[model samples]
Target: MLDFFSSNPIIALAVILAVGLAIGQIRFLGISLGAAAVLFVALGLATANPAIQIPPFVYQLGLAMFVYVIGLSAGPVFFKEFASRGWKLTLFIIALLISLVALAWVIIKALGLDSMIGAGMFAGSLSSTPGMAAIVQIVNGQDPSMVGEPVIGYSLAYPGAVLGTILVAAIGAQILKVDHLKDASEEGLITAPLVWKGVQLSPEITGKVGDLPRLSGQSIIATRIVDDPHSHRLADPQLPITPGMQLLINGTEEAVDKAIAALGEERETKIEDTELIYTRLTVSNPEVAGRTVGDLKTVEHGFMIARIRQGDTEVVPDRNTVINLSDRIRVVVAPGRVAEVRKFLGDSEKSLADVNLLPFAIGLSLGLLLGAIPIPLPGGTTMSLGFGGGPIVVGLILGALKRTGPITWQLPFHANRTISTLGLALFLAGVGTSAGAGFRGALTDPSSLIYMGTGFGITLISALVCAVFCMAVLKLKWDESMGVAAGVTTNPAIISYLNGQTGTDLPNRGYATVYPTAMVGKIIAAQLLFLLL
Candidate 1:
């Protein structure tokens, strides 16, 4: 077994990933380590046999693939968020991370530990494998022989980082006394869309369309209007309402109920034989990409976009809601305009699976170039974004751009996710195998336990402090605060646990809002910690 692994790097990596994933699926105390299992498994294999060596390119390739794809997937929201309320949340997270780095520095000085070891512990305690990679690069650039110390420190502190963050989030939930269900509902975390409601336009609903009471935090789209027994016209916000007229509306279930209460009693309106057709059309037209729903030439094409589905999330689109590539739009069109609508959308299922190789190649190549470029620092030294940070930063920029001229940057959602997952698995496998020998050496060292204990303390303190600040200072909700804490650590296990606990997507929203900035910040900070020391 040892000889086989030693001779074939690919086979060794495969074994690590397969076994790690299997171990990750096992729940202990209702929490599974998830993908982090790969790293521990790799460490075990490496320790068992020192000859099981892998090439450096394997790990670098995995890191680049993982971060680059993650950036692409998160780019749209990350950029959009800066213009909205997300900037404030991002700033707070940055501050928290800075504080954590300072705390690590103080601990390193007090303990009289080597700078490389300190940097590794900092990254490991956050469970940020990418950050650890950055530190390793810096250490190797300065002195190749010193590389082993950081990797050893990283392995020592990793388990604590994962468990510490999970414990903080779980404990924070209890301390905050969060009523998960109530908070989720109040925050509109439940995605309830595609509810068709029919109502009678009562006498009290006087005046024009502009006179209706506004349903705060709800988007209600009127689909059809029944003027009489035999005739009906497409509902428009501008169209005046009359007493005893039947109307069909589309929105969330709660919004529909509110609309019915505000308008009149519930009424049955059948549209089975109507010429107006309701259908789901995939957005494939390059011309419509990046344009808002209201901006689409739907009126000219004899169709009205009632709703749009982006990935699995259904959206009640507004005038400003942008149309993205492959969006499944629920359009209401006339019978004669079906062909025109289909032509405009380019709704081809085969096209969805077919990735535009040009843009994909261009994006990845550009990312590699950006990653290779170096920047000067104040201390007469230099640091690059490295393979980890460079690819992700470039991916974010391209992702936000969505499309430039003929090149559409967006990949199919499922395809993008698959690539990202594969990249991460390969990355962890590489890191684990690369650090295996060092991790084994550190395991027998008496002081290694002290280093790990200190790292755990740093992780716990930083997470607790940040969580409190998010709740008390930022006035964020409990789940949102916990999610931000989890994101700060960059641990997928914590994110999964929070999602299960809340039974809502509130934690996910919080996680996403802070992840990009936190990810980039930690990567850069880890290197800086190593260099400054």
Candidate 2:
């Protein structure tokens, strides 16, 4: 049986995922591991039979995909948060990491353990793969025989590190009595409902549609215009508006009313007659994915975009709004142009379900290339972001850009979630199996137990301290603080777990804000632990 399974590693992996998902669904004391259960299941199975080894490529690929999607999703608000509180969060995480490294140094020295073990302990407890890699390089150069030392130390502490972080976050949120759903809504994470009004241009009104005075910060879209009783077309801000011309405006109630007052009085009339109509359809077109609303020449095509819906969030799109695949957009179209608009938007269900791999592949390759580039350090040494940091850094930047030239850097909401979840599962399962043999070997030795326990203790304390400092001193919300902790720890699993608990991207925002800096800092700390001590 072992020989057969070892020959068919793919089959073994499939079964593990199947069983893990089933086991994850079983709640114990109202707590379930969810997708993270895949890790433990793989660990146990591999411990029994060391021959059931998975390839290293599996986890590395998974890690890159998971983080890249997270970066893309979080990028929209990451920079904004950093601009406001980036320094404080950056400094706070740096201080926490430095303190952890110092404490680890003290305990390691007292135990008379090797420097590599201590370095690995810090990385393992924080679940920092990049940190582990940095220190591993240091060990390899100094003493090639000690290369295995860091892996052993990392493996012994890894299980506790993943599970312990989850517990700390759960307990901390529970103690705070946080209302995550309410918190998300209050922070404008959810979009407001839209309203539309029919208006007739007032005689006093003049100039192009763009020059109209609107309520400050209002998001109003001028959808359609009436040049005559029988002649109606989509409105363009560049087009000159004359008195007695009617317009259909879509926006929030206040914004619509304000636009109506600015343009003309409201009229009891149908903006969409039999010929001119409005249709809300999904954006299933790959060709249009990267283009902004203005770039589409909506008015030239006899259509105007009103609003857009993606996942649970709704948005009022302006000229600058970039259209993503799978978006449900409401547009007003002129007479006899419905087919043209439908064709342009590719209103096909199949297209909506399919993932566009072209941009995804390009973005990921760019990230890998960026990761492999050597970065020089102060002591004539060098480091890189590695797989852990590379994808995420690129993801965030591309996500914020939304597109570059013709390539759309963003994935659809459903696709992003699916890819991230699967990638994370693959990464965790691979890690568990790869470490299982070493972990089991270490378990029998009493000294190894001490090292593992020390790792777990340091992980828990660091998380607790970070949680307190963020919420009490920094005054960040529950999700935000957890996001920061996960970021500083450089563990995708931690942020993934928090995202499931909160059901909001607010945590991702916090994670992205500190992720790049924290990851680099932790790597430096790990190297210093090896080189300095």
Candidate 3:
């Protein structure tokens, strides 16, 4: 059995992972899979096996999808949040990162480990794959097996780190006893209802209050009183009644009793025909490109184009306003005519089909090409153009800057979600496969175990410090503070878990805001530790 297991190591590892996942021990799967992959590679290297290779293209594709989705999720608000509330979180995270680098340097010096080993250790401590890649790039001519070890270490550490962070966040929220209802109300998630059972006239209604007897004691205001009620109502009727009234109606049980007891006369007002005629629809067809808003009128659909939103800008569209893919259009049509308009626009199932695959391909190619370029670092050292910071940063910047290729590139949200989920799952699977093999090695080395322990310790301490700073000094909400903490720690899972606990989606936004900064910090720390040590 032992001989068979040793002979078919990868398969054995896969079987273990499958069992673990089936049993709902997802973390176990991660650890097992990662260990298996690393062991496979290590054993292959030991035996001089040429077949053991991580396909660079497959890895790149997974990484690109991961980064692009992350960037998209972060969106424009990430920068805004950073500019606003990111300072304290950044400061604490940076401080911790610097401390980790210093600690790695000291440990490396004391242990007299190989330079490559120390670099790998530093990268592992920070869990920064890009940093590992960078270090490997700088240490040219190093054994490929040795160069790969740091990435393996990072992969091994990630699931544990994520799980640990999520646990901590859950504990913190429990300790804080964050109330979901109160938080939601504070965040304006609870909106006032549009209509109430009764209508009330305020004391401020001085200028000959219209038909007071008709609306004197009813819950609903007559729709016919105003030709356009939407334009006139300053506030929704469901709100609490204000003072000063020509006619007032009550809604609360006690208030209704008092009104009835007072023998207030009841009058019903006639309903009006003032329903909204326009509804908005996003442009989904690739063939519709270069067509104007006026061209839309040529279709059999009886609708008038009202407005268009192109990216962040909203325009009062005219005939010459070209209809581009992903442009959200507001069209006014007769009541119950939405189906006709949709029919004319073609199948609703075809929206994502319009995404110009060319631009995405171009962007990806540019990322790969630029990522592959070996640019010299600060110390006359060159790094490879790979899945590291240089390529992703350059790709994102260039992609954002390019304007002429496609007027509108709509990210198919559903497709993007599907791709993101798949990429993440595969990436996680790879990490797990690699970690399972290295788990034994990592545990066996006292010094390496110390580094891992210290790394986890630093992450927890950093998160707590950031949380404290955000809450006490910055006066951020507890959820937001926790979110900032998670972000600084570079674990979105924490934010997601905390959000789940709070029963709100706002924590996800907070996670997104902090993730990019955390990524940058981790990479910087890893590299600095390697270079300085």
Measured with C-alpha atoms, the lDDT of residue 438 in candidate 1 is 76
Writing each residue's lDDT as its tens digit, candidate 3 over 1-533 gives 43454466455444433543353323342223322233233332322422333333444465565555555435344555667766555566677677767766776677675455556655544445556555654553455445445544554344455555565667777898877658666865432232212233444432332233223342222211222333222122223333433232223334333443333333332223434354677766554544665555432465555456666445544445666556677654556667877655543546556455665566556656766676567877555545545434543454233234443332444555555544433343333333344444654677565555544654565557666777788676677776766665554345556666676645655566666666656655665666675
* C-alpha RMSD between model 3 and the true structure: 9.8
lDDT of 2 by residue, 247-357 (tens): 767777877777776666986556545457778888887778868887888777777888888775677787777788788988888657888899889888887677778
Worst 10 contiguous positions by lDDT, candidate 1: 208-217
Error of 1 at 381 (Å): 1.3
Q: List RMSD in Å for every model shown.
A: 3.1, 4.2, 9.8
Best by lDDT: 1
Candidate numbers, best TM-score first, in rank order: 1, 2, 3
> What value of lDDT does candidate 1 attain over all alpha carbons?
0.79
Model 1, 114-233: lDDT tens digits are: 788778988998888889988877777878756657777888898898788788878777876789878877877877756887788777677644234353235777767766544556
TM for every model, in the order presented, reads 0.90, 0.80, 0.64
Write the number of the candidate with greater TM-score, choosing between 2 and 3.
2
Best by TM-score: 1
Question: Each candidate: what lDDT?
Answer: 0.79, 0.76, 0.50
Give the Å error, residue 175, model 1.
3.2
Cand. 2 TM to true fold: 0.80
